[model samples]
Target: MPLAALLERVSLTFRRQSVPAHSGVVTFDLGPATGYPLKLHLSTWQSDEPFRWESEADSVTIASGAFLEPPGIAWELLLATEGEALLQGMPVSVRKVIASAPFLGVELAQVCGQLQAARDLASTSPLLLILLVDRASATGMPQADFAEWLTQKQAVLCAAVDLPASKATAKLLSRCTLRPMIRRELLELKRCLNTPQGTALLRHHAPLCLEHFIFLSHYEGTYWPGLLPVVDGILENQRSQPGQSVWLHRQLADIEGMLGDDRQALRRVMSLEAFQRLHDRLLDHFNDQINQVGRAKLASELRVQYGGYPPAPIPGHEDILPITSWEALLQEGQRMGHCVGSYHKSVAAGRVAIYHLRAPEAVTIAISPQADGWVLREAKARFNEMPTGDAMRRIGQWMDQLTDT
Candidate 1:
């Protein structure tokens, strides 16, 4: 029998069976209008929790009595049914409703290619494209491939009338985060869709979207030259106050770090005068550390001699200091003929800053206050035996040992 004929004959209805709290059994009774037999298999599909399903004749009872059924299990069961035997042409209204459903794109992924190909005859090309994009988003792609797809999809969407506010685009943007793996793809999307008009649309739809923020922060000047102007334009156009834009400042600092000009990046985004004050504050902090350690020594002596309620408690030095830029230190090293490569902070929550220098070695610098001052509390280099010119220079200069001024 044709699937369409089978579906036309059967009617599905639900029945409640008694059970405990958060548990129940629902019977699906498929009544054949012609008063004949029907056979259906109840197999588990993708499940969030365990469930028992049994089928007899034209009826099935799905039990969640053992454990509570997940929120969408019933719905999944209906959709996951292997009814290729009963599957046929859906009503125009049903197809439209399914097309608009949030999970429709997700559902499309599980359907047999033959079923999809059959549907292609009935579904519009644009609708299929929309489904394809959504499927692509739900199941990720290679970074390079995803970027290219996003670029092309964005262009198609630009000219598309029916899918102006596409769910696919929404899902993609929402899923994008400041993660290393997806950073390139997100950046590509931003570059493709973030025109002046596009930015306006984005600002209107997603005013505080993190994707834009992440893209700006991770931007590599070496890879995307002259992109700062684009970022500056976006920030300037926004109604947000510059002073209160912590994300802007932080991301700009990050981009600057990538560009090997952290201070310059900070200056462009933040006030140069403010950074100068911060530099002075940093110097003062080191001076204070030196004074505190000396006083600690004196207090130790007093404990031995004229011990009196331990002299005014010295302030503990900050473990992580963001007061000064790393580029400043690197520039200082460069001035002294120490070849510096790209720098990276410890990915873990530690105050260890690592520098790659021409000396062909990784210079690990730890920041802390010692008895003397806020010096390079600890410095070590993991040198390569066969060093490059840059590494050889840095090794010979031995600039890893930058101490307190």
Candidate 2:
């Protein structure tokens, strides 16, 4: 595919650069192009002393992976050129590394420097960093503020164990677990378990596995811990605790709803009339909108265009050609054989209007007057699958009430 098309589809930016010989470091700035930091390093060395090198081999490193955006075509291209450098007598390797989570247990600067070193080594992928905290470190800091601070970091997850439950620390743990993540990413940013007891607690509560599965099929081996039966001993034990069980049920219901398992979601939230009604309303609205748009194209009175060629209405409605002005709204309505009325309402921003079209039914439109043109906001009408001129005036009473408002 063309580069422009690829970039547009994947939301990626591409760039390339060369590192001169003897240069110690090379870095690229990819401001906001990436969600996570990317690091790439190139090193050159010579094993002069056969058995082992008496001194460390001289190397130049390229460190800037954090900036690489999606579908990293440029990075792959650059990495492929490593053989050219190797053939030049200097043994060289290109290392690609994923940056560590921004926040760590240790001093921030020192941790970053260590991560940078690891990225340059070409021995392993970027490491996952987990913070270890003792009672003092966990409690000495204001629990809520520290938790919030951790939450705001780019890629840090926290876990607190059997330590005396402070409200803030508990909140922090909740925040970490509740934050949505693909199973693989969740494992990557896996939070620290402060104590050995934390492990036992995790295993016991592990049955409460509510994961959102959007794109984990490829990484299922790494992310999918075997699924558990919905009603096993674990759920049965959880049922007595209303608060905990209710939250877990709701989470499961949400996942089911998102996965298009409406029947399952309804079973989970049967008592909550509002939940059922909300989902019903949403589905109904979607169906109505789809039907309306389909019918509109077949017998639409107004011809509109944001840009490009306006789509055809229908064979009989071909005369409904594109119009470019607010005046055309009424003219088109009349041509379509409807009683159209419009009035402007004054506002601080200038003037806005409500345009009414009385046909088989009445439609109301909200129009905002822009400097160069008018923009239609809320344009809606209850239209039928097929309509005729006489049917437009058949519901005169309803149309009159709609026009009055």
Candidate 3:
């Protein structure tokens, strides 16, 4: 059967029903006219609860879903399993039509029309056609210009499928215009395609992932052979972490912020472990210097302003002194090798108060206002280690005294 005729026979209807708790159900009806019609129902929630789905076909219902699978995999799985019986003898082009229906939305008919028109193009690979159709649908390129657009994108489209088929590849192809620099990077990625590191880079092409790849490309001559592996390691480590791109972007931005024009220093990073260690060391040094300067200024201002934190009631074994200025907090953190120095904002905002215990054993304490009164949020000794039992007891007694007063 011709691709267009096959698509005509394959009917699809999409409807989204909104309900309470910000939950919704999306249904896709495929080939309702065909005796063996398939219906896929997806139940989505605003909470962390997993998505649930039900697939009904030929009076049999298969219900299953996953928390970890990417957003559209459920629909694809339904089509591959139960819908396969209906699509048995259909051309792969027809199969792509059914698979892309839910995502293509209103553009399904237009995309199908464009696909039929472009069938005579040099490369009509099903994968390439679906990719172009997706891109066209997203960009709203008119049918008149689609042929020109397809011709222009022909080289990149062909090259994209040469790499692995993954969400990353789709994102890279659909979102990015193949500029000279990006094309160069793509070619280099293709060269390493067979290796584990190369395949990983292809698979995990998040925006920050691409930016990191481009950033490393600048130092390619210096880091060669090891650069891709470093990238792969970073991606692998970040894969399990949520908000991976956000985390990666912040880390990279910090490096750029700390080093500025010192590309020479960045060139020294040769491995993923080394990259992470450098980021840590740079962050610590940056925070320490900034905190020192900020604290000194804060202390000078606090001294002039005169109003100070309320004095802590000294117990028998220990003296609890309120940390009235950023300078004192910085000293506490520096001496303890902990992050109390970073609490300057919270202290200034009056959300929390800090104190230092001078006797029995030095401990830094944080107390926040609660419904009743101030409560100890944390008490830590040097290096954020747990304080001794006696030290905690003294602190607790001081808190009780403060509450009573």
Q: Specify the highest-TM-score model's number.
A: 3
| Candidate-wise lDDT, in order | 0.35, 0.31, 0.51
Q: Taking the tens digit of each residue's C-alpha lDDT, what string does model 1 give over 43-146?
A: 22222212234444435322222111122223333544432211233435234324443243223322312133423422433333333444444564333443
Model 3, 94-179: lDDT tens digits are 44443433443223323343344444331243334554555555465666666555564455554433645454444443433222
Kindly report which residue stretches of model 1 are placed more than 4 angstroms away from their true locations once superposed.
1-59, 63-405
Greater-lDDT candidate between 2 and 3: 3
Error of 2 at 294 (Å): 39
Give all TM-scores, in the order shown.
0.22, 0.21, 0.37
Candidate 1 lDDT at 142 equals 35
Predicted structure 1, TM vs. truth = 0.22
TM-score of 2: 0.21
Whole-model alpha-carbon lDDT for candidate 1: 0.35
Worst 10 residues of 2 by lDDT: 48-57
Ten-residue region with minimum lDDT total, candidate 3: 174-183
The lDDT leader among the candidates is 3
Candidate 2 runs further than 4 Å off: 1-14, 20-24, 27-202, 205-228, 231-405
> What is the RMSD of candidate 2?
18.7
